[model samples]
Target: MKKVVFKVGGSILQELPESFYKLLIELKEKKVCDPVIVHGGGPEINQALEQMQIESTFIDGLRVTTEEVLEVAQMVMCGAINKRIVSLFQNQNGKAIGLSGVDGKLLQAKPIKDGKLGFVGEVTKVETAWIDMILQAGGIPVISPIAAGEGETHLNINGDTAAGAVAEALGCRLVLISNIPGVMETIDQKEIIHHHLTKEEVEALIDSGVIYGGMIPKVRSALASLQGGVEESVILNGLEPGDILKYLDGEKVGTILSEKEVVEHV
Candidate 1:
């Protein structure tokens, strides 16, 4: 059976509607493919941290997860967001299981070297066995991006990185659903980049400052997945109902990335 990894960001998770759930049900009913969802809950985590009066910081788009912020991250990512997504699938007549990096030693990581950013992690290992078991049982596994490292160290990993690692490990296609349609050539909202991009092209866009800030990490993660041997990686607007199916059907639904492709002009 084919497998696909869907990386749902905190923004989309918070805004997901009934239509999205219906679409998931459709996918399951059709047996389109086995899906593993890796999720992040940054907004919710930030809210919880604010409530607890813990100041959060970021360095190079990665959250500087201090001890206090890490507590809130664990609570929001594992306790709330993970379970909520699982319940959504269950409500839609689909079997869903919630998991974390700590579960079954699924994800292990090492500390990232941003000295100012406290406990951020870069994924070192991803075990696909548990995820496969859940898929074999006809259930979706919802993963939270908190990894346990050597010793008593638990690190907060970037959601995109975690998702990419999981996809690479499973050799599955990676689909990242974000609020935007896809990458764009211009800052103009209408100029959506709908074609596949090569690594060189991606680098040029970044160097030209067309891609900046938050998009950098996301695009990099997608590239990493492709380089790691995933067949394809796509970035699409999650708000659009049935967009996932559209993309899977070979329709031009988003920005696709892969190695250089030979194009023939007739």
Candidate 2:
């Protein structure tokens, strides 16, 4: 069976309803594409850091991880948020295992940006044997974005990048599950979502200033996954949980991006 990596952000986690988990369970139980999750914990981390009187600094959208910040992030991502996701699945009678990149050296890495962002790393390797084991055993693996770094050090990884890496390693489709409906464009004075886009189309949109700011990184990351050998990348709305199934059914519910200009729904 094919696999799909669902990348979810921390900000939208609480907004996801139980029906979403139930859909995931149905996907697993029905022998559809194997659904794996890589999640973020930004809001929870911010709350934890604030309670501890710690400040967060960001450079180019990445958190500058000091030693203390790393501890709190690790605690929140691996411990609290991870288990909460697992429990959500279990609550719906689904088998789900929560893991961090540190576990079993799942994601081995080294620091990026010349170490300017302390303890922030990129994935150099992904050991997918255990992930396959979990999938074969009929369980969903929910991963947190924390990489094991050199010589007993742990590094923070951006969740989208982490998901892209996993999709690359597994040679699978990557679904970016976010709050927004999809890439929107004003056509005929009506805001309409572009259900399909190629790299050239995306670039044209970018040039026309249709895709700007915050969304640039998102679309770029999706394109990067295609370059890294992922089959396809989709921008999906987590709020409309049913859209996932719609996309899978080739109903054009969200934006499907491809390297080539050809439009293939499924």
Give per-model TM-scores: 0.89, 0.94
Q: Lowest summed lDDT over 10 consecutive residues: which window, candidate 2?
A: 257-266
Q: How far is candidate 2 from the true structure (C-alpha RMSD, Å)?
A: 1.6
- Report RMSD for candidate 1: 3.2
Error of 2 at 213 (Å): 4.5
Show where candidate 1 strays beyond 4 Å.
57-61, 114-116, 185-192, 207-213, 262-266
lDDT of 2 at 101: 99
Q: lDDT score, residue 208, model 2?
A: 97
Residue pairs with backbone overlap in model 2: none
lDDT of all predictions: 0.82, 0.91
Please list all clashing residue pairs in model 1, or write none if there are none. none
Q: Which candidate leads in TM-score?
A: 2
